[model samples]
Target: MFIPVEAPTAFQSFTLVMPAVAVGNVGQLAVDLIVSALNMQRVGYIHTDCLIPMIGSNPYATSAETAGELHTAAEVYMAAEMKLAVLQIRSPIIQSKSRKFRNLLVSWIKASEFSRTVVLSSSHGYQRDDQQLKGIPLRYLVTPALQVSGDTFKELGWIEMERTPPLPGLTDPSTEPRLSIPGGGITKGLFLDSCDAGLSLAVVLVFCSEGDNVPDAFTLVNSLNSWLHLVDNKGSQIWKIPTSWGLLFGSGIPPAIF
Candidate 1:
């Protein structure tokens, strides 16, 4: 359920952006960048039992005064001027409740009446097939309801995610190609659900590995910006890195160890 900090109705017709807990946490990291860059205001929380419980100080806190504010596993932020709302997921979903979580998200999105939704996600780079290996590591998928023109994507120079054929040995001529997103948690499922519900949704994802994926995050977000024009990328304008990312790798080495 959504517990609001302000009027829930404020989100009407807004575009919703969210992340999937995928490999290297690329999606989540990308979301952190957006929230930090926009300095979006907290609007609500998606309180549910489907995700593992988590709570901590605000990740995007600008100063000591705001640093202690309580933040939960899933929270919503908004930039009304941009008609954008972002849902940041901080914890993993309970394996057994994954489906429940997806259902909850779909129901809330429908109820909120968002103009469109974009999901950020990542898959294992090593899993890419021959065709996938040839171009840029990023890919996108749009539902029928979005009704986006292929010309739009073509103009943006974006590539659509491809459906791969069956493995060599299992190649039955009648067998169909399949859409696979290895390591993208709940992404494929959520996309399919949106398709079934006839919702306007699109997915933007990257192929990455399990490591320091900060660069991949920037790449994915910049690609989205090419389409959404979320922020001015011209001149010196750049995506601001969140302060919380300071210790992403770990603490400093102990002098005693030297």
Candidate 2:
């Protein structure tokens, strides 16, 4: 269920952005950069039992004054002037309820009547095939409903995620290429759901690993910025790193350890 802090209708026709729980959590970190940099307002939250319940101090709080405000597992933030909305998911989905969660998201997206939806995600770098390893680490996918021309991506110098043969190095003609996103939690499912529903959805993701992924996050967000131009990047230090990110590696080591 989506519980609104303001009018639910405020989301209508807005472009929705969200992250998939995947390897390195790069998508979530990119979203953090967007929210902190834009100073978007909290609009609503999706209260679903499908995700593990969790809460903490505001991740984007800039000062002592705002530090104590609570934030939940999944919350919506909006930059109304830009007609953009972001859904940040901080907790993992319950394994048994993954399908349910995807369905819930699809339904909410449809009901909200969003102009389009963008999913940010990451996949395992080591799993890439020879072709996947040859180019830039970034890739994109757009559902048919978007009616996006291949020329659009070609002009942007972006590569579409390729479908690989189910069995690599196999000579059998019966085998067909298929879309695969190892470690991209729910990304494939949600995209397929959007496709079946004829929703305008696109997925932007990076190939990455599982440690010190901060740089990967920057790379992913920068790639997204190339397409969306969400912020002016001409200046130095444009994207603000949220205060919460400071503790990403955890509190300082104890003096006794030395």
TM-score of every model versus the real structure: 0.96, 0.97
Task: Give me the overall lDDT of model 2.
Answer: 0.92
Model 1: what TM-score?
0.96
Q: Which residue window of length 10 is worst by lDDT in model 2?
A: 147-156
Off by over 4 Å in 1: 168-170
How well is each residue in 56-159 modelled by candidate 2, as lDDT tens digits? 99899878989999999999999999999999999999989999999999999998889999999999999998899977899999998886655877787778
Report the error of model 1 at residue 99, Å: 0.6
Off by over 4 Å in 2: none
What is residue 220's positional error in candidate 2, in angstroms? 0.8
